[model samples]
Target chain A: MNAGIRLMTPVALLERFRPLFEPRGVVIAGASSHPGKFGFVAAHNLLAAGYRGEVFLTNREGGEILGRETLRSIEDVPAGAADLVFICTPPGAVPELLRTAARKGIRAAFMATAGYGELGEEGKLAERELATLCADLGIVLAGPNGQGIVSTPIDLCAQIVAPIPPRGHIAVASQSGGFVQAFLNYARKTGVGVSRAISAGNCAATAVEDYLEYFADDPETRVSLIYVEGLADGRVFFEKTRRAAAKKPLVVFKGGTTAGGQRAAASHTGALASDDRVFDGMCRQAGLTRATSIEEAFELAASFATHPLPRGPNVFVLTTAGGWGVVTADRISASRELRLMPLPADLRSAFDARLPPRWSRSNPADLAGSETRDTVVECLDLVASHPEVDAVVFLGLGIQSNLGDLERNGPFYPGHGLERVVEFHARQDTRYSELALELERRHRKPILIATELVDCQPENPGPATLRAAGSLAYPSSHRAIGALEHLWRRARRSTAA
Target chain B: MSAGAPPAPSRTLSEHESKQRIRAAGIATAPEMLAADVAGAIAASREIGFPVVVKLCGDGIAHKTERGLVRLGLADEAAVHRAATDLLAAARPADGPVGLLVARMIRGNRELIAGCLDDPTFGRCVMLGIGGVFAEALADVAFRLVPLSARDAHEMIDDLRTQAILGPFRGEPAIDRDAVATTLLALSRLAETSPEIVSVDLNPLVISDGRPLAVDALVEVRGR
Candidate 1:
C-alpha cells in the first residue's frame, strides 16, 4: 500500500484525484494583473482564506501575487511537491499545460478554463491528446471547466468563492460549480461546518470514483454528501460507494435525474447518467441514502454527525403541549411498515395519576403545560428508563413561565391570574434543558428534541440543549423523526454488514 | 448483451469457394467470374452484363475499403475488359495470382449494420444497429448474447436509438422484426460455437418492406 501511494509521485497526485477533500497546496497557473482573469479571482480567494500551504502563481508576466512567488513555467516548481495545479489559462493553452505537467510529474490538475471535448472534433482531438498524455504519465487531471475545491481542515480554498469553510465532518463533492459554492456558504451560515468541498468539473482524468476512494479513508469526514450530475464509470462507482457506506454514511442528491437534466449532464460531463431505475437500484445496493433535494442532503448529514444511530423503530414522545403530541406521533408512524408502540400501561397510569384524567393517556404523553422542570425530568426518566422505548423525542420546553395552571378554563386552579399564566409557560425552556441533560446522562437512549416555540425562532432552549446535551435538536418533529428513520436504516445496514 | 460466435474461415479460399459456403446456407449472393485467360475473362464479363463491380480478391487485403483496390460502375465491354486486365496484372505477384470477385452492384437508400464480437467476460454476442458510418456516429446499436430468446431480440431492438428507423416511416412499410431477430440469434449461435472467429462486419443490410439482405460482408479470424 505504501509503494502504491509512493509510485503516485506528483505530490499533487492524490490531491488531483480527490482535490476537494485533500488539497494540501493549490497554485493558480494563469494568474494575472488583469482583474477579469479567473486565475486572479481564484488566487485571491486562496490567499484570503489564510491557506497554510506554499502558494505559487504562474502567468506570462510573472510578479508578486498576494506576497507569493510566481513561477513562469511548470519546470520551475520542484517535482513531487505541488499537490494541485489550477489551469486558469485559455482553452487552447490547456493541452500544452497537461503535457508540461506530465513531464514535470504534476499529476492532479484542475482546469478552471473551458473549451475542448465540448466543442467540435477539433476540440475533441485536443482533449484526447491531453488524456493520452495523462494516461501515459499516470497523472490524474480534473476539469478544464471546473470551479475547484474548498477544504476547511487544511484551510485550503481552491475555489473562486469567498470565505474558506470552517472545519467539520460533512464532506461535499459536487459536479456543478455553482452548487458547490452555494453549499459552502450555506454550511457556514447554518453553523454546519464543512470538512471538504469538491467541484469535479468535466472530470477529464480524475472522476467521482477517485473522490469516493479518498473519502473512504478520510478520518475527518464522518459523513459524505454527493451532488452527482453523471457517473464516469458505473461499475467502479457502485462498488466504491458500497464499500464507503460500510465505514461512513454517504448521502447523495443525484441531479439530472429528469430527462432534460440528463441531457444537460451528458453534454457537460460527457457522461451517460443511465436510466433512473438502474440508478435507484445502484443506490440501494451501495447502501447510499438518496436525498431528493440539496436541503435534505445537508440536513441529513448534519443530523447524522451529531446523533448516534437509533436501535429500532421503538420511540417515546413527551411534550408539554397537547396537539403537538398527536402531530409528532402521526409523522413518526407514517410509514406502513413502522408501528407506533403505545406507552406501557404501568407508565401511562403513573402519568395519569400525576395529571388530570382528560390529559389523554397514550404514547406522546402530553403533560398539557401543567408540568414543571421536575415534571419533565420525571417524564423523561420514566420514558427513557423503559426497556421498550429505544429513543425519545421531546417537544415543548417548559422553562419560560407558568409553573402550573397549564389548562385554561379548567378548575385545576380557579381564577388563574395573567401573571401566573405567563409564569406557567415561561420557565419550561430551562426545565426541559435540565431534563434533556439528565436523560442523556442516565439512559443514553438518543433523545431527539423539538418544540413549537422553537419552530421559527432560533433561540429556543429545548432544541439547543438537546444538541449540546449530546442529543439531536430540530425545529420540526418531522425532521427529528426523519433523522431517526435515517439513523435506523444506517444502523440496520451497518449491523448487517 | 450480445451472444454467440462466428465460424472461422481457416485459410484463404477462392471466390467460388466463398460463394459455395453462402449458397449452402440458402442465402443468395451476387454473381462472380474468374477467368484464367484474357479471352475467357472478356467473354465472361460480356455474359455477366454491364454496370458491375470488380475487385482484387486476395488473401491479405481483407480490408479492401482502405486499400482502394475496388473498381465500381464498369459500364461498357471495353471498360470491363481494360479494368480486369489492370486489376489482374496488379494481383499477379511473386507468390501467386489473386482471384477477383466480379459482383453486381445492389443499390439501396438504407444501410444497416450487424456484427459478432467475442466478449472476454460474456462470451459471443451479436450486435444489430443502423448501417454504415451513421451507426458509428450515432452509436445506435444493441447487442444480445447468443442463445437469446425472441423477447431478448425485441428488447435489444427497442434499446437502440435508431429503432424508429426500422419501423414504418413516411409511406414505407415496416421492416421485419422477426427477420432481424433471427439473424441476431443465428449470428450469436455461430459465434458461441466457433471460438476461432474473431470478428464479423455485415454493413448495408439493405431492407425493403419486410425483407432484409446482407449485401456486404467481412469476416476476420484468429491465427491460421
Candidate 2:
C-alpha cells in the first residue's frame, strides 16, 4: 500500500491472446537442415506433437526439413495464410525477420532467438526496438530469448527436447525457460498431465500475464499454474491472475517471495519490486494459493483437475492402521484449512455393522485391521455418504500389500505367494482403486489416497490405475493431508469475480 | 456523496472531523460536544455521563495520547474540570484552529483495526487486522481491493490471523462482524468515490458491548 505510486491501469495489454495459444497455421522461420540446431528441434517437436495445422518451413539454403519443403525466405509464405510464426533466427536478425512475418499478416510470433535484453545494454536496446516494432504491427511475441510453447489443444509443441505431454486440464506458464523444462520433467515423473506449457523468456512483447489471461478463457484448462520470476507491470499481473483464479484455482510458484530470492530473481529474470511481502498480500487479495515448491504447485494442480472442491473444511481419514490414522489426523489438525469431522451417528451405526467393535469411533475412523475388501469398500461408501464430512484421506492402498515379500517367498507362500494368486490380487486391487475413483465422482468430493510405497511397484498396478483415474496417491499420509488442505483452502476462497 | 462536503486537504483532519466522515458512512461514533472552557466541559461531561475522556483536539494534532493531552476516566465534575483545563492548556495547533474535545469513553472487550489505503499494485484496498500496541510488531493484517462487495468485507474480517481474539474471548461476546462489514464497505465506498482522501487509519476499533466503535481515527487528506 505505498503512496505516490502510479496505480492507474486504463488498459490491460494481455487481453485477446487466444490466437497465440490456439493457432490455425504456423511457419518456422529458421528450419535448419542440421539436427543439432534449435530450429530443427522446434520443427521436430511440432511434428511429434501431432499438430494438424499446415506447417511452412523456411531456410536460407532452400531445402527440406523433416520432409516439409522449405522456402528460401519467410516472404515467400502467402500473406494472412499463417496465423503464427516462430522466429528461430539469431538475435540481430530477429527484428528484420519479424518485419517480414508481420508483413505477411502473422498475428502472433514466438521468438526463439536469444541474447535480447538478458545479455547487456546493447541487447536491451535491441529488445526495446523489437518490442515497439511488434506492438506497432499488432503481433503478440512470446519471447526474444527463451524456450518455446507446448499446447495440447492444437497439439502445437514448439519447445525443444521435452516430449509432448498428455492433454489434461492443468496449464503451465513460467518466466524461466530452463525451469519450464524442469516442470515438464517433474510433470512426467509425477504423472501430472499438462494441457499447455509455455516458457516465456525476456517477455519482450508477450508477458507471463498474457498467457494467464489466455488460459483463464481456455476451456481445456481447469487450473492455471504459474512460475513467475519478475513482473514488469505488477498491477497487470495481479489483475490477470486474480481474474483467472475466480474461474478456477491458481497454484502459483512465485519465485521471489524473499529478499535473497528477489535478488536472485532480478539476476535471473530482471524483476523489480519494493517488497516481496506486498506480493504475498496481493496473492491473498486475489485469492491465489502460493506454493512453496514445484512439487506443491503440481500437487495442487492435479488435485484441482482430478477432484471436485470439498464442500467444507471437515475431512475424514480412514486408515487400516491406528498409527497412520494418528499421523494423518495430526497433519489434518495442524492445518486450519481442514479439520476432522466427528463421526456422525449414521456413519457410526453403518460402521458398527461392518467394522469390528474395536474400531475407533471418532473422526479418523480407524478400521482397526478388520477390513476385508468388502469392508474397505463399505467404509469408503460410508465416508462418502456423510453430509458433515467434506473430504476423505484413505491410507494403506498399494505397496503395503507386500509384493516384494512375495518375490522373496519363492512363489508358494499362501495368499499372494503364487504367480496366479498375485495376478488375481493385482487385478482386484486395480478394480478397488477404480471403484474409489467412481465413488469420488459420485460424491463429488476429493478422496486423497495414500500408499506406503511408490507407485509402479513390481507387479502392483493399483496405484498406477488409481492415478490414471485421477485419484492421486501420495507416498505418505502427510503429503495426502497436505494435498487435501490445499484443495479445501482453494475451495473456500471468495469467488472474487 | 450526501450533504457533507468532502474533507479539506492542505492539512490533516482533526479527530472530530475525521469521525465525521466515518459517521457519515453509516458507522456509529459516540455523541459528544466540544468545550472551550472548564465550565462548558463539565456540562458536556454530565451529558456524556461518567467514564468520559477529554482530549486536546486541533489540526496536525494526530497523536494527542502520546503528547499527554488525553485524560481518560474523568468520573465526576471535579475530574472533568481538571482534565478540561489541562487539555486546553496543552492544545496548540501547528496549522490553524485548536480546541478541547470531550467524548464518551467506549468500553469494549477486544481491540481491532479497520482502514483504507490506496495500493499501487491493487488500487484502493481495505484492511482489517489485530490492532493495539502489537499491530506493527505482529503485522497480522488482511487486505482486499476496494469497491468491495459485502462478502469481500466479511472475508477481510474473517481472514485475520487472530480469529481467536475476535470471538467469544475472556467471557465476552464475539465482535459484531456485520457491523464491521458495514464499516469496511463504507470506507471502501469513501475511498472509491472521494479521491481527496489519502487514507483512513482507525486503530483499536474496540468491540464495545458486542459492537465495533472507532475510538481513535485520523483521516489524511490530499485533495484530488
Candidate 3:
C-alpha cells in the first residue's frame, strides 16, 4: 500500500490523466461517413458537443465526415497534431491501430471497440495482451470494450451515445456501459449536470480505481458515483476508495450481492463472511455511502452536488400539509443517520404567533393548510437560521401550482377574478423555490424542497422553477429524507475520520 | 506399530493448547488447568472451585463433545473423579496421549463468535458475530481486513443487526463493548503474527457478568 501511494502521487496521477480528460487535440480513428456506425457517432458527438480543441478524423479510405476532412490512416495524421485518439474499429484491428496511434504521439487512447474480455478464455487472453501492450508503449488506455468518455469541463462528449449531460460537478464511472448512460440520462432530465462520465468496459488497462483517484483530486468534481459488479483486487480497491473518500464523497451501488451469488467457504468465519457482508464492511470502513438501488445512488450524488455538508444529524422537516409531515416524520424516526430535532420554545412561540392555532407545533411544524407566501418563506428562514437545525426538508411544493392549473383549466374560467388568482399562485411557488436556494446559501444548511413531482406536469411552475435555479425539488418526502440521510452519514464519517 | 500410515496433514489444537495460544495474545479465557490423571483432575477442579467442566484433551481428539468425551457441571471432587475416569475410558486408540482439561463451568444467556480466516480475495480478515448453535442460522456477522484499528473494532461491534442483545439484557448489564473490541483487536494481531494459522474459531465467547470468556476454542493450523 505504501508503494502504491509513493508511485501514484496526486500530482503524478493528475498529470497522467490530463491528456485523457483535458486534451488539447483529439483524433477519431475509424471515423465513418455512415450515420449508423459507432465511428460516426463518436466523431459527431464530439463535434456537436462543442469541444474546444482541434479535432482530427482518420479512416482507411477517408474523405469527409461531418464536413471535416478525414485522413486515410493514422500515419497520414501529422505528428503532435493530437494527444488523444478514440479507437472505434473492430477488436482485431485495435492493436495495430493503437500501435500506429502511439507512434503518432497519441498519449491516450479510448478503445470504443467490443469483443474483449466479456467473452471467455480466449477474449481474456487478448485483453491481457492489450493491457501489456499499452503499458509497454506508455499509453493511458481507457477501455477495450467501452462505450466512450464524456468530460464536460473540456466540452468533450467523445462517446458513441447521445444526450451529453448539462455541466455540473458529479463525476460518474461504471463497470457497466448501460448504467453509465442511465446516470447521464438522469442528469440530463433533472438538470443535474456531470463533470465527467466514463464506462469502464472490461477495465483492461484503466480500472475504476484509477478514475476514482483522479476524481478525488479533480478540481471540477465535487462528488463521484460509481456502479460496480465485481472487483479484481478487493484490498487495492479498499485502500484507494478509503483515500478518495477522505477527500470527497463516493456513492457506490454494487450488483450480485445475494446468497445465490456467494462463493463457498471452508471455515465458520469464512462461511459467515459472504461477499456482500464483506463489501458492506468495506464500505463502512472506507466511509463510502453504499446505496441499495440505482435511483438512490443518483439522488445521493445529486444531494452531494447541490447541498452543503451538514454540520450534524439534527434535521428539521418543514411542510405545508399535515400528511406529508406525518409520513416524513415517520421516516426520520426510523433513520439511523438523522434525528428530528424538537421545536424549541422560542421557535415554537414564533410559529404560534404567525401560524394558525391548529398547527401541530412539533418538529414537522405542520402548517395545516393555513400558509401564505410570506408565512411559508418566513417559516423556512426561521428554521434554517435556528442553531439547532443542521438540515431542513421542505415538503409541499407544486401544491399551489397544481391548484392553479386546475382552476385555470376548469369551467369557471376567469369568472371570479380567477385569472389573477392563478397567476399569483404560480408566482408565489416560484418565489418560494428561489428563496429556498437563497436561505440555504445564507445559513450554510441544506433546504431540500420536495413535491409529488411525478404527478406534476412537465411545465409545473414549482419543479420547473427549482430546476431553472440550478437545484432540484425531489419527487417525494421519502426520497428527500433518504438523500439527506446519505449526506449526513457522509458528513459524520468525514468528521470521524 | 506399523510404519506404513502417514501422519495427518493438518491438526486441530486441543482445547487447552488453543486457549493458551489465544490467551498469550491477550484474549481472556475461562480459568482451567490440564490434569494428567483422575487424582490430578480432582485437584485441578478444587483449585478452579466447584461446578467445573472436564473434557478429553488431545491433538488427535478434535470433536470431543460429539464423541461423548466431555463432562460438564462437575460440582465436587467425586464428580470430577468419576467424569475424568469416564472420559479417559472413552478415549480411542488413535487419540494418542490425552489429558483431562478442568475448567470453571461458564454460564451465560448471550454468546458471541470471533475468529480470523484467510479469505481468498481479501486475504486475512477477522469476523465478529452472534454465536451459539444457531450462529449459522442467524448469520449476523461483520468482517474487517486484519490489523483492525480501534475504530474498526468498535464499528464492527456496532454493525451487528441484533444490537438490542448487546445492550443491558435479561437483568444483566450491557455487554462490555470495549472488552469485545479488545478481543477482536487481539485476534487481528494474532492473525497477523501467525500466518501458519489457517483459521481460528472462538465460538461461544460466553458473556458472563458483562464480560466475554472463551469457553471453547479451536485453532486450525496448516501442516502438523
DockQ of each: 0.02, 0.14, 0.37
Question: Across residues A56-120, which tens digit of lDDT does each residue of candidate 2 receive?
Answer: 88999998888888999989999878888887888767778888888987878888888767776
TM-score of model 3 vs. true structure: 0.94
Worst 10 residues of 1 chain A by lDDT: A1-10
Task: Candidate 2: give the TM-score of chain A.
Answer: 0.91
Candidate of highest DockQ: 3
Q: Candidate 1 vs candidate 2: which has greater TM-score?
A: 2
Specify the poorest-scoring 10-residue window by lDDT in model 2 chain A.
Answer: A1-10
Candidate 3 all-Cα RMSD: 4.6
Judged by DockQ cut-offs, is candidate 1 incorrect, acceptable, medium or high?
incorrect
lDDT of 1 by residue, A308-416 (tens): 6766778888887667788888987784323467879989887876776666678878887676446677777888788888788887663353234344435554554
Per-candidate local distance difference test: 0.67, 0.77, 0.85
Winner by TM-score: 3
Better of 1 and 3 by TM-score: 3
> What is the Cα-based lDDT of residue A170 in candidate 2?
85
C-alpha RMSD between model 2 and the true structure:
5.2
Q: Write the per-residue lDDT of candidate 1 for residues B114-154, one digit (tens) a residue.
A: 76765432345567778756766886766654545565566
Which candidate do you rate higher for DockQ, 1 or 3?
A: 3
lDDT, candidate 3, A32-69, per-residue tens: 99999999999999999999988999988868999998
